[model samples]
Target: MDSSEQQDNLTESSGCAQAALFGPFQLIMKDGAEVLISNRRARAMLAMLCLAPDEPIDRDHLSRLLWPGRFEAQAKASLRQCLSDLGKLLAAADCDLLDISRSRIGLKAGAVRTDLSDLHDLLTEGKYLEATERLVSIGAIPLLDQMNYGEAFDDWLSVHRQQAEQRLQSAVSVALSALEKGDNLSEYARLSSLWSVRHPPAQTIADRKQGKVRIAVLPFKSIADPADHGFFADGVVDELITSLGQVPQLLVAGRTSSFQFKDSDKPPSKIADTLNVSHLLEGTIYRQGEQVRVAVSLVDAESGFESWAYCYDGSLDDMFAARAEVVQAITNGLSDALKLTEHASQPRKLTSDRKAYGLYLQGRALTIRAIGDGVLPTAIELLEKALEIDPEFAECWTALAEAEINMTVFTPCLDRLERCEKAAGYAKKALCLSPQQAHARIVLAFYAWTQNDIIGALDLAFEAYRLEPNNPDVLNRVGSFLLYCGRSRDALPYIEASIDQDPVNGRNYAILSGVHLNLGNIEAAVEAGQRMVDLGFPSLWLAAALAVSGDREAAIETYQLTKKLMNTVIYPPAGSAPLNPDAMDAYWLMAAKGLWSGKDQDRKNYCMVLEMLHATLHDPCDSTIVLPAIWMGEAPMVFKTLGTQITTANFFAFMSLWTNAEPINRVRLHPDFMDFVERIGMVAAWEKYGWPDLLPKPSTII
Candidate 1:
């Protein structure tokens, strides 16, 4: 055949053939046959050639692009092999897809058709209809979906994917504009829904503008059966949060903190006080069939006055618009929107798929609930499904990471290493998708601590805190890390702030108790510990405080209460409210004796319980074991444990035990203890935090 005729035939055949580059890469022949390119190099080669069919790329360039790490000779050989394999595969499909020569490689123009090429052309021509059609046909997937080539190919894939997504967004933006101009509202909404599923927006960064007016958007209450419209209320609340967050003049409380009052009966003023905000935006969602009514009020917390109240009645499809109106009203309630930044008043669309958005909100609520309960597995399942529906949802990714971390810490399903790897992987994925995600960074900080990178952990935690200063979870995580790293006094303020944001949060009380104990504020420690117990948390810290405060009867009663509550007689009782470590150990043994008062197996049980307690605090610097050892007159064990854990981040914890144990305080004169003191630099910590009042006086001999 002549050259022109051959070219026409090739174009016709190529048009008949189909290539899908969404979700997964696939090549199908005109005769309904499939072309499989399983090798990574071959796939990369095909994708690059197909993307630019008309241009002939040099063989050397192709080789380096595909195998950048290989030596020149090795890369050339590998490329040649891939070419041979690709040629055979194409031959089987009865197509000459490549123009291969010794010097150059190229795709035979019009010999193969691909979604990527059509997408590029349609977008280049600014044909929004055809572009939207092409995007929908391929399901709006990431470019070269799920392919893992080497670094070079992966980098190329990432750039192309971003470029493709931007094009898709441009088309969707045009549709949205058309809707704004009174045209094709339904069709544009449909297109926008697909685009949203394909490209869910990331969580809004907390405002950093100085002197911003603070507000808390309470979870919109459902005025109907929650089983019917709870998701609607949650979705509305989430959108309102994102909308209000865009206002540079507003310092919005995070969704997690605001949602803490979801089921609370507290009035608007009380909720505002708990969240430490001047204004509260409370709302309710009432839905009937296709119509919805949203009532919102901006209340002045201090004066108990409703500064603005509005009820928006609209179609369910206008939920986004309704939220935008509410946000504008809120801004007006604070100040004039016309005087605010232009971006502050500009309405931003969060999601067009209410179902997917509702699923995401539900997943978040479940994950937050799982923080205290142990339903993390269910939370994870819900989040995973939400991401399945909207893979690019960065907030869902962050929530999934948090749920996985909670499972790792609070549940006993996975091994430590597996849990660490999974939790870290999720956190990294969240950060990769949204770099400014504070919750993701908090998980990463916890992961870093597990990896023993104390400095890096603290840095990440503090950075997360700065991003969302009002987020109680961030505050608690950062504060806990500080306590772990021996900055107890530094941790106190953050923990206290967390309590202010989430007063009934039992974990905050637990952390507060620990911080107070670390700082030698025994009374404050006891008070916080009591709150923790009243809130249904473990009572071990309270028992420890009582034992240390010379309240023997109360201490014993607390231990017995803890045992009864836990349904296990595992803890020991205090006797005579021990004055020193020796007496403390004796009291514990005496308590153990009382436990087996009538059993002939008393001796065996006491030994078993003692060993169990030792095992519980097996960590080298655990103050639990060290304090008891000092009180029990086991000086050698105390020194041995300290010497082993001298390089750990909890060096100050060991020093605290050594200084306050009263009996082991004699270690101040021992050469080994002095060497360790200098090795871990405890002298500086002591000078900074001050020595505990229980510390023994220096020996004149020393």
Candidate 2:
């Protein structure tokens, strides 16, 4: 055969296989001709198998997913028919796509290529910009578009997409950071240039002449053997950060961001620019026999000058005392250099036992990373072990509480109410151990919010923020709560402060996006949302913000791609327990319809669902159900819920939503609302926070 004919034959033998589910479920093949399958179930089955290429899915699980409401026998029979049809379809297309057996099924290894697989590969290779471009190009493709497979499948797809988006987002962030530092410039120039010009990062500390004193404490260098003294070196940096973070006027970079430069050969000036810190602290630790030696210095970001230097020598047994001494010296030096009063010359010690303190530091580090899904239990174990070593360790208790709350709120692997109860217990114990513990206060604030004690929650959140002004965790928590409660303007400064302290943190960007969205700063919100995606903390807020900001086409596209995942989790199918479906529904309506434009019937249906959820579940607060009820014109249901809330001292919490003008203002005319509001001290809160403009003028006392 001629060369042209041979090339054609080779092309025909390399049968094309296409699979994508980000928007629509699309699967096809071509051997010089396109292959089409008419059966929807067959197509869905192929997609499912292809989604987990090379991993065998049990027949029972596949049956349940494909026929959620069917009996086992009937479901398995249906699955068999689908598999047979899919096998024949692939064979006709000249593709070897399935590996089916009596007990298991999966896509044939190396025989198929999928968008999902390609996206995952890009993320794994750290090609964030490429991954992002691929995702954007997919443009709101729904997972298995419009397929009625069942809620089981829906729920799985939701989590699957969420995870994928998170990976892509993380890649974006790392890529952007790399670009900023002149790494892989030519390779990622397109993404870097586009993102840099379109969504410039928050101004770095080097760009700002005046603000809170920003600082980064670099991980200490270890001169001793790697295994024995490595933890000691880390412990010192962690301790110093904790001690420095107590100063209200200072902004301390989080360990995760600062420690990224451990053993880095980059100059101090370069490190400062990368970390966005005006000042840097460098240190070294060396342990030999019974003696421990430490050396440290502070550097000025702009001048690249060493401002101060210190060395400490002490017995390894006296490490805690020596640490206290060193901390006092650093704080004094920093206070002098910054022209600010030192909050305390000596930082408060967490634990007197050096071994216990080391364990606590280890646990603390783990908990910081525990914010990611499925990682909380590990942190919880470590924190609990640390507490066991020193039961009176108030900080350990607080850490445990924080981890429990994260597991409950951020992950769906645990019983939420149970986790909440455990979190409250830990927080209370921490408070009892040390009444001034800021983290415990924040945990209690979360408990208060859950219980519908909005007034108490806000009070606690503010108290925690005030106590630990430089603590990024507390700053973000307070800011997030304020934003959620319709105090976006008030929340902005706190959120910005957190970003200043932890500029590279994905969580900080996420909060910034929410704050911007709440303030109706569309461009800022979009930029922040994109930054979050870049940072690999994918969330649905960006799409909602775009929708609310009048970018209908983009919003709809994003929504279509994410709706299944959003819906599965927000409006969970029967038999699954979501943390708070009522709240999720309220959030969904707000995100999808600008919080103010749901159809009357849609609102009513959601209100009904909310009522059912409230009745069936242990809802400590009325706020979740009340807003949706009010939004949907279900005045009677709202009033009834408020009545219960008032009786339970949750009235203040219900009134918390009253500060949100767009929805709350519209409900003031409900005859029963004003009477309930007066009885619940709404006037006092309004006086303090300023009244929502649409509230009725002061009328006759109820």
TM-score leader: 2
In terms of lDDT, the poorest run of 10 residues in model 1 is 200-209
- How would you encode candidate 1's per-residue C-alpha lDDT over 1-702 as one tens digit per residue? 112322332344445355655544556666555566777678767776665556687999878878888899999999889888988987777777788788999876677776666655555565556655654444323445445557876776666666656765675676568665867666665555445334411111122325777788888878765466487788767766766665666667766668778878988778877677888888888877778888888788889888777687888778645566666665565454224554454443234556666676677777777544446777788788877887777777777787776665454332444665676788888777677677788777666654545445655765675555556677787667656444565567667766765666665776787677767788998999899787666665675566556664676567556544543322222111213646555555554333323233643454344455555542434444444444333445556655554322223233234223323345544446556544444433332222223332132011
Mark the regions of model 2 whose C-alpha exceeds 4 Å error after superposition.
1-212, 222-231, 246-249, 254-267, 287-291, 336-343, 372-374, 559-702
TM-score for each prediction? 0.53, 0.55
Judged by whole-model lDDT over C-alpha atoms, candidate 2 comes out at 0.63
Top lDDT model: 2
Model 2, 1-702: lDDT tens per residue? 112322343342332565654433555453333345667667677766666565688999988987888999999999888877877877776678777788888766667666666666665677676655654344223334445566788887666655555555566677657766877665564453233211111222123325568889999998886555477788878778988877656778987778778889998889899788889999888888768988888899899898888788888887656677777777777777778776873354367777777676666666777554446677787778777788988878888898887665555432565677788899999888787677898888777655546556655776675456567777787666655444565567768877777777875775687667656577897888777666665545566467556575675455444434433534232234554656655545543443334355544555656767677645523444654454344556666676454322132233224333234345556777767555544444333332332342242011
Estimate every model's Cα lDDT from 0 to 1: 0.60, 0.63
Model 2's TM-score against the true structure: 0.55
